[model samples]
Target: MDLTGKVAIVTGSGQGLGLAYARELARRGAAVVVNDINADTANAAVAAITAEGGKAHAVTGAVGSTEVAQALVDGAVETFGRLDILVTNAGMLRDKVVWKMTDEDFDQVLNVHMRGTFTCVRAAAIRMREQGEGGRIICIGSPAGQRGNFGQTNYSGAKAGILGMVRTWAMELQRANITVNAVVPVAATAMTETVPFLKPYVEAMHNGEQLPSFARRELGFGGPEDAAGIVAFLAGDAAAEVTGQAVGVGGDRLALWSHPDMTTTAYHDGGWDAEAIEQEWPTTFADHLESVGEKLPEEASAQ
Candidate 1:
């Protein structure tokens, strides 16, 4: 979809998936404000976009800062006259099992992915409301958040929190015509390369070796561009009605995620006492309990 004359801001866009989103938006005719903590990479992204006949400017700063967030929004309007889209894609990983994870690691991930998104969205929403043209706010989420990963408690918590914000903002901004959504992307970026299980294939790709067919079939479309298409679609006019969604994007696949809901419940006249609940526990909740990283009896043999 064409985004002609629309001005957009993408954070953490110095490289990887953020860069892909920025470049694609520019290619679709939107003037872009590329924000990154690294000045050199931000400048390079801007130069690349400009060289390809697209409009873009670099804003270098840590996205978690309120001042930086405000500057990004103001800079976009100052450079391009209006803000229409925001892609909060700035993030980092500090993977460690829960027992080993430091408070610093946890806070750092949350600061960038969670607080960074909040600050940027808060700033962009103000501008969009003032301009009287409702805008798109796209937050990048992760599969790790939806289904927990072994060593990513911090990252997963932050990403899952983003989806919560997306739903809340979508409802709050509906009257203003703004839509907020989350994209849970599985892409082979610097972040994904950190996973020990995926490291061999990532290195193989870098070395120009042909990937095993099964592996290729599963993850070949894990490139940033593959996921960028969905971001571009959500940012465009066609997706105005598609807010509050957590959409999965990966290798040749796009899927809608179910929102949290009460699946089942057990009730009694004037809630049961602890003794009564214990007596009925097996019949009320035991059989219906959700699995936590465990295989069902039917699938145990397959493993």
Candidate 2:
């Protein structure tokens, strides 16, 4: 859609990927509500948009709270009269392996990422349903969720939960014309710098900044704008037929999203035969792996 008169509320729009998405949307004629916990950053983003001849306003509040979520929706309606798009982009990280993870670490990540997404979506959907003109809900996901990360159990779990929620929301809201899709982006941002394991990978992504010598060996990293384009499309009429799907945007590549392989094949018939299972189960795995012309990797096969 052109979005000339639409209103968009983008959570965590104070900076980084969220700011890029909100600014780009406003540039396309949407009146944006730049929502962020940092009042100064949110206001700065709005000011920048207005300086560029676009309509935008800042709404500062915690994204994890229902009250703040409602306030953001209300701000959009109060300022622009109606809501057309909601970008649930607020998130934080508390990286730790599952074994080393603490209750506080896990709960904090879930609260900010998963619960925060629901807060904004729930509040926005109410407004969209009331308006009866349809709306867009675009969420931010991560590859860490798709391929489990080494030290980010909490982050991956929250991101994966979003995809599950997206599928359910699509089934319930499609008839109302509200499309809910997610963008799994691997862009360089401030969050990346704080993670010990991800710092070098992210620092290499700085557009005008210097890259470390080691980073020169890798292809490169993506900028925030690289992922914003897809979000804009999802929020517009161009993606009217797309819903309940996650798009992976990383650097110069985009992928048709896939979920984890959670299924295991076993020989079975209409009834479970103890004798058959005992006789065939041991050989099934070896035979299957051999058929692929390669043995399972030594580490995994040994296990």
lDDT of each residue in 36-132, candidate 1, tens digit only:
8999999999999999999999999998989999999989988899999999999998999999999999999999999999999999999999988
lDDT of each: 0.87, 0.82
Going through the candidates in the order shown, the clash numbers are 0, 2
Best by lDDT: 1
- lDDT score, candidate 1, position 218: 47
What lDDT is reached at residue 176 by model 1? 88
TM-score of each: 0.91, 0.85
Quote the lDDT for 189 in model 2: 88
Would you list the clashing residue pairs of candidate 2?
A: 1-236, 1-237
lDDT of 2 by residue, 18-116 (tens): 999998999889999998888899989999999999999888987888998899999999999999999999888888778899999999989989999
